[model samples]
Target: MTIQRHVPATDAADRAMLEGWLDYHRQTLAQKCEGLTDEQLRTASVPPSDLSLMGLVRHMADVERGWYRRVLAGEDAEPLHYDEADPDGDFHLTGTETWQEAYTTWQAEMDVARRNAAGFGLDDLARGRHRSGERFTLRWIHTHMIEEYARHNGHADLLRERLDGATGD
Candidate 1:
């Protein structure tokens, strides 16, 4: 799969730099999923772990909604595909959810995230109660999102390798 790689700006404002990195990481995840089939995407990374390419997509969609819609935009975001009842539903396809749905949902959330973020500056304050009951800022959310994607992209790398022996930056 040919993943579309975007060159992040070398010299830019703080916001641009952060956004560029975040966008870069986003594309990286998509690149990892580029050539995978439904079965391949649904393939778990390791035993006792439900992590997969499609699962990552679903989980990231949830993440995008949580941060961009709920936290950033304060849009009273409801659960996208998971809840307290089944926290891991994002990763559990169970043959009910198709790979296409995951991709479309992920892209849709990405769109919302981008739109929601457009109005805020880096230092813009958005009150959000984390799962741990901690307040957060839009800046923190941006940095957290980058780290989240980087961590998951690492897992994606391993998963892709397991799936098709693919590897590299």
Candidate 2:
């Protein structure tokens, strides 16, 4: 499927702008993984680092769930790919999940994130605390999510270019 990334409007309200950019980055990540076989999606960037396109998708899914469901909505959501014993489990795939599965899961998490944030204003506090024991406002979460995707999307660009010479913003 083709991923459509809309550029965020420069003159929009804070929440609209944040959501637009976040979605753009999300679609950017999806576009980076398009047209690759499962093995190619799972291919590591380097010998030591287990980072791959599939791993990024899995990681983002967990990130969305953590921030939106666990924090914002106060839902008892569990991590899909990690635990205390294996904190980075999402990035270290067991070779059983297909690319479609990972993509579907990520999209589902995104849907939940949108729903969870719909009723909250920018200054509203989250229901949960960060690892540092600090509570976050909706604005902070939105900004942090954009930064998270932006950084990971950069890694995705490098990985994609390395895999198939495909690169773009």
Candidate 3:
């Protein structure tokens, strides 16, 4: 394993740097999913699990919709990519979906997330009380989403590499 070190941010504002990290991962994830066919995108290189590149795109879309649109906006809406009726529906077979559709949906979701992020004050309070009684603010959710994207991007790196030896950071 190789560790890459990023230089300390020269930017004065901590929040901007954090936002940059979030945007960076969002873009990185998109790049990782670029230019693959539907079969390649949905192919589970590792059996017994349905972790596909296309699936990740769908999942991230759901995350953005759920977090920014639903949780942050406090909207009463059904969850995307998730259902008690079919827990694995999103990943298993995205249903003859064209590459453009998948990519477009991912881009749209990211756009919404960006718009939502723009509306927040540096000190804006975003609160969500978890089922476990833990509370989170918008700042926390923003950072957490960045962490989520970064972690999944790592998985994407390996999975894509395994598929075509096309590895990247």
Assess candidate 2 and give its lDDT: 0.93
Ranked by TM-score, the better of candidates 1 and 3 is: 1
Please give the CA lDDT of all the candidate structures.
Answer: 0.87, 0.93, 0.73
lDDT of 1 by residue, 59-123 (tens): 99999999988788878888787889999888887866777898888889999999888888777
Flag clash pairs in model 3: none
Q: Against the correct fold, how does model 1 do in TM-score?
A: 0.93
Q: lDDT value for candidate 1?
A: 0.87
Residue 156, model 2: lDDT of 96
lDDT of 2 by residue, 1-169 (tens): 7878899888999899999999999999999999999999999976688999999999999999999988887789989999999999999977877998999999999999999999799999998876677888989999999999999999999999999998788
Which candidate should be chosen as best, given lDDT against the real structure?
Answer: 2
Tens-place lDDT digits, model 3, residues 90-146: 676655865677778877877887787677665565444443555456787788898
Q: On lDDT, who's better, 2 or 3? A: 2
- On TM-score, the stronger of 1 and 2 is 2
